[model samples]
Target: MDPLSDILSVLKLRSYVSGGFDASGEWAVHFGSHEGIKFHAVVTGECWVAVDCEAPVKVKAGECFLLARGKPVRLASNMAAEPISLQFLLPPTHDGRIVTYNKGGEFLSIGGYFTLADGQADMLLNVLPPFIHIRNEPSRATIRWCVERMRQELCDPQPGDFVVAQQLATMVLVEALRLHLSARDRDEVGWLFALGDERMRAALSAMHASPGSPWTLQLMAKKAGMSRTTFATRFKEKVGLSPMEYMTRWRMILAADRLTNSTETLSEIGHSLGYNSEKSFGTAFKRVMNYPPRQYAKL
Candidate 1:
């Protein structure tokens, strides 16, 4: 897999809920602080979205937004419409989980929340803005398709509608991240954006492809076709971590996954990640994960 896929694949999703909401007649709803990421697309009509106390942005049909972490969000037809807590406004789910408020029909949206495994989402979220607003554009037709299909899955229940909708939710998330990376400047710094950098990609790809390989600064620099000093400085600037530091973090994240899900012994897991001894691997794991392999397994 590519770097983005690698990171996203490692992120364990606990549960996901996919559905649509409909409202009409001077309606506003306050979505209290939520866990994981909440995403939505305006299927028809427009709404004012205020997130984390930031100024409200108008979202028209065909546009979408991703809200990360536990940010509180408010959506309304107009600010003049008093906002009610979502708890009060949300109608019980339909057969496929569509909900409604007020008269329900003038404004419509399709959305869902992903409950990622605790601490797992930051793997992807760290490189993203707290809130991402994707405007409707020729380049974002995928978003439109995904939203439309999601609406179908929710509006008409099927045997596997839940499974299909969850996958579509993940697809939207990836598209949003890809859009963000493409729009960023070359000088932008973040592991996700750095993956898109032409000059930095080779070196990062090498590390991802073979985490167990012996790697030195000169070697990594060579992969990037640069001198050690230049590559180190440039990589740090663009990726927000020295090459080796990034490698260790990546390796530890892999190890954490194995520790939680695999039956391998500490030494086996460590050796697979290039550590020669259990002690050395445990030391590195503690530094990165704050827990030894045995202890972390129970978590």
Candidate 2:
């Protein structure tokens, strides 16, 4: 698996809930705080999105965005519109089905939220921004398939709509991340965004493929086809960390996953990740994770 795939697989999904809001004219809906990634796409018209304490953003038709953290969401046709709780707007009986605020038709959106398993969300979640805004045109072509399918499933409710909508929402989340990677119009920087760069991706893939390998800066530069100096500079600039540092972090992450899921002894886990002794592995784990392997497992 590639780096993204490896991290996603480790961050196993728990459960999902999806719903839609259709409103027209002057209106605002406040979606309360939740502990999961919230994703939504505009099906028609436009609205302003305020995730958490950040500034309001105008989301145009055909555009989509993912709220990385489970912060409160305030969506409005006008930012100043008085907020209305989604719960009061839609009774428990009609939840998950499209509900309207006032005369519906002008502003329509379909979205969902999902949570990852315990003790593993930080691998990717921590690397992402508060919200990722993916515009149409280029990104649309990449995830339009999932988006269109979701639009259909959301607009017309049928048998098993809940399950199908949740499945499609998950697809949208993954594809949206992939789309953000491919688009070149953004100013975001990090390991997640660095996957967009071809050379950086090559080096990252090498690290993910054989994290146990005794990788040096020179070896990583070779994978990226650059001199050690250039590779080190560019990797730090693009990934926000030195090449070897990233390798160590990745190894520790893999070690943590093993610690949580595998029955391997500390010595076995350390050796598998290229540590010569259990002490060295424990030290590194403590440095990166702020806890010893055994203690982390207990938590």
Highest TM-score against the true fold, candidate: 1
Off by over 4 Å in 2: 13-17, 52-55, 117-120, 155-163, 184-188
Error of 2 at 59 (Å): 1.8
Question: Residues 120-152, candidate 2, lDDT per residue (tens digit)?
Answer: 676677767778888878547646676677768
Please, what is the whole-model Cα lDDT of each candidate in the order they appear? 0.85, 0.82
Query: Cα RMSD (Å) per model?
Result: 1.7, 2.5
Q: What lDDT score goes with residue 85 in model 2? A: 87
Q: Compute each candidate's TM-score over C-alphas.
A: 0.94, 0.88
Per-residue lDDT tens digits of candidate 1, residues 29-104? Answer: 8888887888989999999999977999999999999898678889999877878886665546544376787668
Q: Which ten residues in a row have the lowest lDDT in candidate 2?
A: 10-19
What's the residue-level lDDT of 91 in candidate 2? 71
- Candidate 1 has a TM-score of 0.94
Candidate 2 structure, TM-score to reference: 0.88
